[model samples]
Structure formats: C-alpha cells, structure tokens
Target: MDAANLEFIIQMLEQDTDLKEKIKDQVTEFDKKTRTMAGLLNKIHSTPTAQLPPLLDSVQPILASCTDITAVIAQLVPANQFWRWKDMWCNSLRSAVFSATLIEYLRSGTLLTLPQVGGILGIHPEWADRFTLAAEDYLHGLISLVNELSRLAVNSVTLGNYEEPLRISAFVKDLFAGFAMLNLKNDLLRRRYDSLKYDIKKIEEVVYDVSLRKLAPTPAK
Candidate 1:
C-alpha cells in the first residue's frame, strides 16, 4: 500500500468519530440521570433516619432509567473500550449505590455487600450470560458513601443520636479496611481511597466524643 493510503486507514480506525460522538451523547444523558439522583439522595442526608426509606421512592423511577442507559452504553461501546466508556457512568453508578446504601444504612444501620449493590443497579453479579456491568464500579460508589456517612456520624451526634455515630464509625472503618484489600489500579479510585482516611478520623473523633461523654446509648446496665 502507498504511504498516504496506509496513514489514512490508520486515522480512520483511530478516529472512529461517529462511535465517539454516540458514546458522548449517551454519557450526557447518564450525567443528567446522575445529577437527578444526586439531588434526590441529597434529601436523604438531611432527612431523619426514620423517614429515609420513603424518600427512596422518588429515586426508583430514575434508577430504572439509569439501568436502561447502562444497557445501551454496554451495547454501543466496543469491548476494547468498554471500561473507558463505563467510567463515564461512575457518578450515576455511585449515586445508585449511595441511594441503596443510604436506605440500608438509615433503615438497618448497615452497609450492603457488593452483590446487594448490584441489585440496586439492576444487574446480576453472577457473571452469567447477561451481566452487563462490573461490581467494582458500584463498589466505588460506596466509597463516596463512606465520605457522606462520616459527616452523618458527626451530624448524628448533633441530632441526639449517639448510637448512629457509633455505627457510622464502625462502618467507615470497615470500608476503609476493604478499600485497602483491593490492589486498585485506577489512579482516580486510589486518590479517593486516600480521602477515606480523613473520613475515618472524623468518625473516630465523633465516636470518641460520644463514648467519652457516656452519651452513647448502652444497653441498660
């Protein structure tokens, strides 16, 4: 082949401009869905824990929409570029994770396992025939929740709930430990992992104050 002809072929393959724009358009929709969810879940932060689950009602419809968008994105991007385009939905994925975790946290004062997180994202983790996304993306979302829960731990103490802060401290500690177990290769995820330390410290401080004050509600002794 002539030099100019070979170079043109390389540029055509490399550009894949149509596919890039298609991915971009879908990602824009994903971003909107994420912001919508983030806004809805934001209400959860201020909401009394008792009333939290009901607030999840508003997010249910959007979760369905986000799930559909995820499936479409999976089909649009080639396998080679899957993870790259998938990264675009991390915010939405995390928001879904946050919503589920927050609902679980407020309702039961516990964190959901990654499989459970998959349930929130409407995908199966069994690696079966139809699994469209990875559990790792949703797990990253939980990291964001750890940050949210740290503030909640402090706020819980302010709200006259010593027990919740104690729970938050324990939960954040566990999440911190879990993040440490993974040999995370993603630079952005690793950086976020670094921030967990500060959240851990914040929760610890709250726990310490709660215990020191003897304000932490203990079973009748």
Candidate 2:
C-alpha cells in the first residue's frame, strides 16, 4: 500500500511538468551535495568533525522531500474510500463505473469514453432511444434505494425511539448486504472482463418472493 501510494504520488508529480522540474531540481541539489561530501569524506576519513557537515546538509533536503511525500500520502487517505461511509460510496461509484465501462467495452468490442458509455446506457438525452428499457428500470431501482436510505436515516433521527432506531439499523445493514451483492456482481463483471475479452450482457435479475412468519418480538431489556 505504501509503495503504491508513493508510486502514485511520484506519477502525479511527474505528470505535472512544473512539479517535475522542481522535484528534479531538489534531487539534483541533493545528489551534488552528496557527491561533494563523499569526496571530502574520502580525504578526512578518520576526522569526525569533517564528516558531520556533509552528512547533515546532504540529509536535510532528502528528509524534507520525504516529509513532503508523507504529507501528500496522508492527505490522500481522507480522499481514499476506505475511511468513511461517504468515501465508501465513492468506491461504490467506481465499482459501478468500471462495471458499466466493462459492459460497453464488451458490447462495442472497443474502449468507449465515459460519455459514450453513459450514452449507450440510456443516460444521455440525445441517444435515449437507442438503449433498452432495462437501463431506465435499473436506474430507477438504484435511485429508489438511495431515497429509501435517506428517508430511513431522517426518520430514525427524528423518531428517537431506541427500538425503532435498532430496526432502522438492521434495515441499513441489510441495505449494505444488498450493496455487497452488487460488489460481488462487480467482481464477477471484472472476472468476465478478463476472461471473455468481449461484451457480454449480464442482467442483474433480483427476484422478490415475499414470505412472512409470525414470531414474538424481542422483549425490551
């Protein structure tokens, strides 16, 4: 993780031409100082005093560079999805985006731009007629789930009944479990992307078969 984080930072820095030049300048300075110190150290091999300045000066910029990189990595943590629920939703979005992208790649036998995928998926107003009814249906279900969760959170806070809140919590957990199913679907989509090497339409068909059982409610403690 640390290596990947560092690599990503370096990549980002390298991509920014101005930042790359600055980093290169610091690296050049550090290298020059290290070489100059090494030459001095060779002459005063046994002298502790001679070795100190080069060692200290040579290390300062490297330490500063590391500190800057560390700070950048620290900032990326809050931006990463593993930290918070809102951020986790970003993960969910990524999973969805990749899945949709995979689908488009499969169907078209070529990589499609995001707007193109959105268009193929019935999202764009101009190309709505080209897509299937299933696109609208799936989108509606997803929106409905989002609205339901929002409503539940609001009601749970407003009611302030402990039991009701617990029930809400259970419902939220089940909703997460449903999302887990979607994650699994995404994993499957990724695997298919790797293996099939083409677009395959995988319908997410959720069957609702209702069943009810009467049981005594848990007694309040």
Candidate 3:
C-alpha cells in the first residue's frame, strides 16, 4: 500500500501491542494474588473445621484486592473488545472464582452464586456486555472446587474429622445435581462435569466408611 497507509497500520499495531502488554502485566499481578489465596485456602484440608472461619477470613483482603486489578484491566480493554483479550485474564479470573467459591463453601457450606463470585472478584457476572465473568469460566471454577473437595474429603478422614467428610459429600452431591441440569456445550466443561460423578463417589465412599465404623456422629432424630 501507500507509505501513509503503511505507517498508519504500523502505529495501530504498536498501540495494540502496548495495550496487550499492559493487560498482561495486570493479569500477572492478578494471578499472583489468586495463587496466594489458593495457598491459604489449601490449608482447609489439614485445618480443623472449627478453625476454618479464621483461615477463610484471612483471605478476604487478598480477594478484595483482585477487584482493583480487574478494574484496571477492564479499563485497558477497549469497549466491545472484551472477548478479543479475554484469554489474557480468563484463566486467572477462573482461578480467582474458584478461590472465592471454595472460601464461601468452607465458611458457610453453601455454593457461591455467579453474582456472588462476581461481587467477590469485582466484575460483572454474565449479564454485562463487557468485562463479565463468562459462564464457562464460572463452570470451570466450580469443577475445580469439586476436585479440591474430593481431596479434602479424604484428608478430613485422616484428620479424624469424619463429620466434615459427610458435609462435603452432601455439598458435592448437591453441586453435581445442579450441574446435571445444564446443557453444557463446551467440551472441556462437559468433560469436567462428567468427572463430578467420580468426586461424588469418592466422597460417598468416605462417608460410608465413616458411618460403617461409627466414627461419624449419629444424626439427631
């Protein structure tokens, strides 16, 4: 093309590159915070259930910081171009969602809704036209939570927290039931959903063993 056209194209490419670099830097920071939260949450497997509230509470500041980074990334993204650059932060966002969901579950034994997770991460949840948490990412985080809970089930038994395994079993089965209602089109999400059955089975086996041995406390009639 003409010299002016070629120069304009070059400038546009440079701007895009600059924007991408900035987004990547913010995403790196976000990922670091997410990993820190994950590490703290991992303690749940070894921690007594009575002490879990403090551990869950300690991660609140770290989780809250994610909102600020997300806002900066949202600003860097051009309007209507969220999908174009989503790959830069989608995985990190999903990891953050997992941490939030896991913390909520540990704290209250309830699943965090999409809006709740969005609130925790300081982003829109599936409704906003821009900078929203994709449904696929949210589903992926839930699957990760299932996997972690399975591990926690096994560890709870080791820690002599037999009741915790039963609680995890019930919670995971409820989650599996919820997932079964979705007509998931994403192959990865579908596969992960399929794996939920195995987690449920692992947790059930833990519960069964505890019940059979009378290690778990008997429920009040």
Candidate 4:
C-alpha cells in the first residue's frame, strides 16, 4: 500500500486502541464495585430474614456507583459500535446484573427481568442500536442466582430457618420450569441450566430434612 494510506490506517488503529483502553479502565472500576456489592449480598446466607432489608439497603450506594461506571462506559463507546466493544465489559456487566438481580430477589423473592437489570445498570434495554444488556448476560445472571439460592437454602437450615428452604425449593423449581421452555443453544447456558437440577436437588434435600425432623411448620388444613 502507499505510504499515505498506511499512515491513515495506523492512525485509525491507534485511535481504536486508545478508546479501548479508556473503556477497559471504566470496566475495571465497574467490576470492582460489582465485587463489593456481591460480597455484601453474600451475607444474606448467614443473616436472618428479618435483618436482611437493612443489609440490602447498605449496598445501594455501591450499586449506584456501578451504575455510574456503566454510564461512563456507554458514553465512551461510540454509537453503533457497542457490539465491537462489548467483549471488554460484558463479563463485568454480567456480574453487575447478577448483583442487582440477587439484591432484588433477596428483597422481594422475585426475579428481575432483563429490562429491569438494564435499568439498574443505567442502560437502555429496548434499543437494539445502542448499548444494552444482552439476553445471554441476563440469563447468566439468573443462573448465578439459582446457584446462590441453593447455598442460601442449606445455610438457612443450619441457622434453623427451616421455612426458608421450603420457600427456596419452590421458587427455584418454578424458575427451572420457566427455563425448560426456552431452546437454549449456548453451550455455557446449557451447562448452567444442567447444573440447576443439582441445585434443585440440594434444596429438596434441605426441605426433606426439615420435614423429616419436624422443623418446618405443618400446613393448616
């Protein structure tokens, strides 16, 4: 190629590299905040259900900080180039989604929809032409939620919160049923989905032990 053409191409590559570095810095900050939130949320397994609201509330500021980082990332990435730069931030985004979903579920016992997850991250979920949380990432977060809930189930029983295990068993089974309807083609998703059965089993075992030991409350007939 001509010298002028080579110079132009080199400049374009250097600009792209500089942009990627900036985005990566924001993503690193985002990941750090997400890890902090996750660590705080992990206390739920040991915390009493009555004391959970305040625990969940304490992480709100960190979550808001994560949202701000995501907003900065959105601005740094050029329009129509979200997919090209997504790999740099997708993992951190997925962890952020998991933290948000877990906090919501711990607060209300319901799953956060993909749109809600996007909202928590300060991104647009409806726009296909701009930065948004990918469906795969949301699903990955749900898979993580299931795994965490299973651990919570076992821990709850240890804390003598027998009813919590029963509740978790029902919720996880319902979630697994919903997942069964989707034709998941992603290998990671499929593997994660397969692992849900094990989680269900762990929860069921907890429920069974509670029932056998007469720890869970009997139904009022």
Candidate No. with top lDDT: 3
Give lDDT tens digits, candidate 2, residues 1-221.
Answer: 69999999988767655534543444344344434433432332232433445544543343234333222322333322223222212222332333333223223324344455344323434322222122323332333333333333333333332233234334434434444454334453334323321111110010010001212245367
**lDDT tens per residue, model 3, 96-205:** 98998998888789999888888878885442555888888998999999999999999988887889888888788888888889998768789889988888888888
lDDT of each: 0.73, 0.34, 0.88, 0.85
> How far in Å is the alpha carbon of 54 misplaced in model 1?
1.9
TM-score of decoy 3: 0.94
Q: Least lDDT summed over 10 consecutive residues: which range in candidate 2? A: 202-211
lDDT value for model 2: 0.34
Each model's total of backbone clashes: 0, 2, 0, 0
Worst 10 residues of 1 by lDDT: 124-133
Cα RMSD to the true fold for all candidates: 3.6, 24.7, 1.7, 1.6
How far out, in Å, is residue 30 in model 4? 0.6
Model 2 backbone overlap count: 2
Estimate TM-scores for all models. Answer: 0.79, 0.20, 0.94, 0.94
Which whole-number lDDT from 0 to 100 does residue 193 have in model 2? 27
In the range 40-63, model 4's lDDT, one tens digit per residue, is 998998898889999999998898
The order by descending lDDT is: 3, 4, 1, 2
* Over 4 Å off, model 2: 1-136, 183-221
